[model samples]
Target: MAANRIRVAKDKAELVKSLVASKDTTGPFQTYVEVMVFAAALGVKNKKRVPLGETTKREPSPIPQENFASLGYDLIIKLLGINETKDINILSSREEQDEDKRTQIFEEYANAGLEILQNELRGSVDYSERILLFLSLERDGYPSEKQEFDLRSFL
Candidate 1:
């Protein structure tokens, strides 16, 4: 299973590299990878599962916990090129385990990808333009329900 996961990770890395190389930052492929990275990081930090339809006792924050269960942290780490043992250990350490801190660290990782995407799209386009394009594509074709949900929930 571990080996299979490694294979999958390698394949995903290749795909992401190609997407990055092609400079398709605002496209579905880049968005999917970014969302997966964020969702997975949330899963890693959130140990307990809050019951559905119940408001979490935790303070209000941006990233929704409800979506974390669908993505595994290990996979996210691989996709984001995070140094598994070093990065995960640092983030998960008891001394640094506060929810806010975890969220910050996760955001840093997630935002790095977003920054890359933005840089790729810079000069050529603006966020609103990309969003409009995405909206049009969503309207024209059957979008992946999970991707759409993640994109909406994250934003």
Candidate 2:
């Protein structure tokens, strides 16, 4: 049986570790799952997908599905698959191939996102501030309602 753990591309392992808060590093997120989820979302937002290469090193380590599943990230996986195939039946099958497809989508997006983040964060010592600024810029770049009532608009 194949292992069911979610993977971080070997090349992006250090980036992942540096983004998560830990005793060794005071990153913005509290856990690896949080960082990866955010990365996956970023990838989805930017419409980028990058396949994993040389993942055998697994520096930050592969995450068990339960970690994200417990936090409801599995829905994001399923949603990505459905979006990619435009078939809701992708969600109904319990076959290993279907599961692998979802996992592949997630990993590719996360890998692409990590690459984007790495470039954006290069030479920056404060990831939290940089990330907030990056997010603000991204928000500003998007067209939205002129009278939108978002509370974040005030901040």
The number of the candidate with the highest TM-score is 2
The deviation in Å at residue 93 for candidate 2 is: 5.0
Off by over 4 Å in 2: 1-3, 142-155
**Local distance difference test values of all predictions, in order:** 0.38, 0.84
RMSD of each: 17.1, 6.0
Point out the worst 10-residue segment of candidate 2 by lDDT. Answer: 1-10
Task: Tell me the RMSD of model 1 versus the true structure.
Answer: 17.1
The digit string of per-residue lDDT tens for model 1 on 1-155 reads 11111111221233333333235544343333345363334334432222122212222223343334344444343333334334544444355343334444344444444334334445544454654564476469756677634566667
Counting only residues 3 or more apart in sequence or on different chains, how many pairs clash (N, Cα, C under 3 Å) in candidate 2? Answer: 0
Give the alpha carbon lDDT tens digit for every residue of 51-142 in model 2: 88878345678888788889878788889889988978777657887777878888888888999999999999999999998999898875
Which residue pairs clash in candidate 2? none
